[model samples]
Target: MSFKSIVRELKEMRDGIGSTSRRGGSGSRHWHSRTKSHIVPDVTLAPLEHVQQGQWANLPFDLLVDIIRRVEESETTWPARAVVVSCASVCKSWRAVTKEIVKTPEQCGRLTFPISLKQPGPRDSPFQCFIRRNRETSTYLLYFGLVPSENETDKLLLAAKKIRRATGTDFIISLVADDFSRSSNTYIGKLRSNFLGTKFTVYDSQPPHGAGMQLNSRSSRRFHSKQVSPRVPAGNYVVSTIAYELNVLRTRGPRRMQCTMNSIPISAIQEGGSAPTPTSFPQIIDKHFSPSPAAKGKGLISDLNHATLSEVPVQSEGSLEGLVLKNKAPRWHEQLQCWCLNFKGRVTVASVKNFQLVAAVDPSHNVSPAEQEKVILQFGKIGKDIFTMDYRYPLSAFQAFALCLSSFDTKPACE
Candidate 1:
């Protein structure tokens, strides 16, 4: 039989003697009345005796009925649940006492990982689609790696539809470089528009079957357009070069060293979008890649504790008036114990794949080739930060990630 069945049967056997002993021992005390020497009627106070065996079994009414009911709800439960509406099938005593154990609504695990598109049949891939489309359940993580085909795109859309219906708000969509079909020149822009309400993050890097794409000084890494275009079309969202590694699945081998720096978006391909000469994207960032000391706070609370204010309270509120501005605005985080703001800005460049970031204003440094090699090795050591990006992320996600990065070397001010 199955393991659960084994456990259930074992549980039932153990319950009989154990439960009986517990119940039988509850009133084991004895009391005695006055003796016959005084000439009054003599009485003996002793423990109450259990009923005789046949006397217990031959009871005509409800007392016997209750005894059976407790056994079913208890570990001795023989699920006398009816076969039909009324027939309990076998033993009459248990059948009379049967009832169901209750279950809570949210007790079941909601989502399963990795919905395969290749293996068809009642394998439940479409159920994932239904869950996303219908929004009937919530999933914390989703992984879709269907190779680019109309069928695959259709399946992906079906899943997206479900997420939209369920969330009643735009859901975040993340796709690897190989996820889309060879549909058309405008596919990326179209995908962004179709998912207009939802947040979109499209990665631009070669998959395992291809060679790694090298980045340039500008931070916008470009690929040969013999098939795939170098530029991803612009849309109403953020697009930039991020470190991409091959072997998204490879686990063994002296893991390949990979890095993609100096990134930019497709929209910034225009002349104005690109940075000025000599002020290359990487140069600007490398100038300011210095590690800052985590300091004590400078405000009154710091005074109350007699502590100094931290140099940059993890979150920087750029301006108090503009929460909606793509700029930083003041917001309070109680756990961080200070009022702060968050601001994210970008500088996009054309022609090159590794475009520089404009908003990362900091003290300049000459980034050496050795330093660059070290950053690439860091990606090899920690792959998650390289492959994933959170689009339109709230400050909390950034803060938590920063907290994690703090454990690493100091965190980079990446856009």
Candidate 2:
């Protein structure tokens, strides 16, 4: 059916909800109308038989479930998938049901809600996505698909604006394009770098482990400036850190890099293992609160440095910790006289920003060859202002995107 038809059904379902509330006794569940555009009456304003656009109707629970399930199953991809979002937007009851019916990215491998950006990708394969850069605005926009044309409508997954700093650089990531302020609801997280641009940290506005984890005072003071609604968290939780090693000798080679996923455990790299996934959007408790790039054309590089961006709280190491990712080394092509890693045709351009990531080897654990060679994440340039990003389990789109953004920063010491 057409999207309009689904919306019509949803409207009917919403109206049905109100009808049942009035006819049924006091024990019946009541759903509060939250949106300003829609209003729920305190008293019975009209007879049960009469209905209005804003009035609620009682849709059978089974029917409501079936309809929403169909919509969720039918529209699996974007633009078309917006129908599912529309269903959630209909009303409180609708939203609850839609959320229940929709599965997390780890289970379904589909991004139906905004929260999917922070959830781990499918364990079996990587989710293919692309990035579009706007040089004029110094903004980087991430889209859900490999959208080849600039004019075509792209499914925006996330947006990051590069803000340069005296000591280093910062990229404020958000759900909205223009707004980067941490106080705003659109603020999701950010990437911060050191003076030399050799080391970087990925910060999440909400706790990655869940609601129970609290941000330390130092992390809170570093970001929060204004009071925020209780629905969105205001603290900065470090999810991961990206560090490029400094080459003091000025060696001419591809950059070597490492990613320490603080939120994920080393056991996650093992077969049949899983990673932590956030269930809902973080809410900011009023009490809890709280860069541009230069290198235009360079290859991936890696090295180590002692200097850190700042002294942030380091979670005590547990038996489950130590999930480090190192850049997959590229083999030198004899004919081309350059290093190369098989992107499997996902990447077209040969920019220095291209690199693939895999779990770092640990002598303590015995990981299989398949898991060892699996590319957890890979990003490469396809064109000017366009790049391909593919990521799999243990890393969400947000983490993958933030790591890719690091490639855009000028790392003179590493290169």
Candidate 3:
């Protein structure tokens, strides 16, 4: 039957039913006793035709792998492992693809641990390491995948410990290392932060057995017999220095921590240099609260007013060497009523224990308002006692690594 004819017949049947109902009901009380019935459609829908789907599912497996590879190689792959793990959960095929491209520990950059920290696994185990804080001693512990089996667990087996002293803005840390026997400890070097955490000085402590001292002498034997070693030499044994430049500053709020690390000069540490005296913590706090004397005088006020009208330098983006990094220095925030560093750019959030050291053409610049600044190093937190560093071309791996260790100046949770 045609659709139009079927529809007309249904409409007529509905009209007849309505009329019959009206006729059955009419007399007074009987009008209210009429019965009604519901009508439902009895039509069936036709099945849909099959069509082609998107080609994404049919993409070559190698092509998908190439896409992932590019992402892994990017500079912003800080949380790369987490991103890859997420991709694995997308589908069975993606999971298989990601597994093949996963980076092993040897392939990835090194994971550093704070001094005195212990790892929590079998000594001979492989890539991952766990780090935790020791609340009682206010110290950090590091654990690695593989440690020598003969190394005693009870004693602190530390290659180096970079500590942020309880009191200074200076990144000064006490370092101790195992003696030649690998059984006892010795004071090896002192890493001191300079130029407001922009540079560092490493001083080698004098050996306990000084030259010309008779080892078999009674005095020497008595000195060596003590459980704890004698105090380290306070003289000049400066070995190297590290300088850093602050490149980018990413700040969203006043509460978030602002930090970074960059490159060091080969010449800065070639011969020993004098360590800069650290400014006291109390002095830093007082300076933040104190108002400028220029605000108090009429003449100084006019000078300051003139200075405010001057144009400020705009940061330009370019190669790492050409980029200027300014140290805006900490300023008072009226809204926050707290001291804050003016990074002077869109603040990018950085993770803990991650840092980079970039070499710049000019490592030094005047701190005047008109001068363009350059960053020598950039560093940030990656994890507890862990950070990443990228130094300029001149620094050796050992020098860069030493400077990188000096960047951890913040107090850990245990403290």
Best by lDDT: 2
What candidate 3 gets wrong by more than 4 Å, as runs, is 1-185, 194-199, 206-236, 242-349, 361-398, 410-415
Candidate 1 global TM-score: 0.16
Count of residue pairs whose backbone atoms collide, per candidate = 38, 25, 41
Worst 10 residues of 3 by lDDT: 38-47
Per-residue lDDT tens digits for candidate 3, residues 1-415, read: 4534533443454344335435653431121121111001000001111101222234478876875565445422222223333333333455456545643322344221111111111111222222333344433333332221244332122234444444333322222221212111122234566434555565433211111211334334433432322221222233344444443353422222222212222222222311111111111111222112221111111111111111111111111212222222445679967554322221233433333322222434322322222333333333443332332222222233444455454432211
Model 2 per-residue lDDT tens digits across residues 73-148: 9888876776677566554466668889999888998987777888889988789999999999999989888655
Ranking by lDDT: 2, 3, 1
Q: Give the TM-score of candidate 2.
A: 0.78
Give the candidates in order of TM-score, highest first.
Answer: 2, 3, 1
With candidate 2 superimposed using the best TM-score fit, by how many Å does residue 381's alpha carbon deviate from the native?
0.7
**lDDT for model 2:** 0.70
Compute each candidate's TM-score over C-alphas: 0.16, 0.78, 0.27
Per-residue error for 337 in candidate 1, Å, reads 9.9
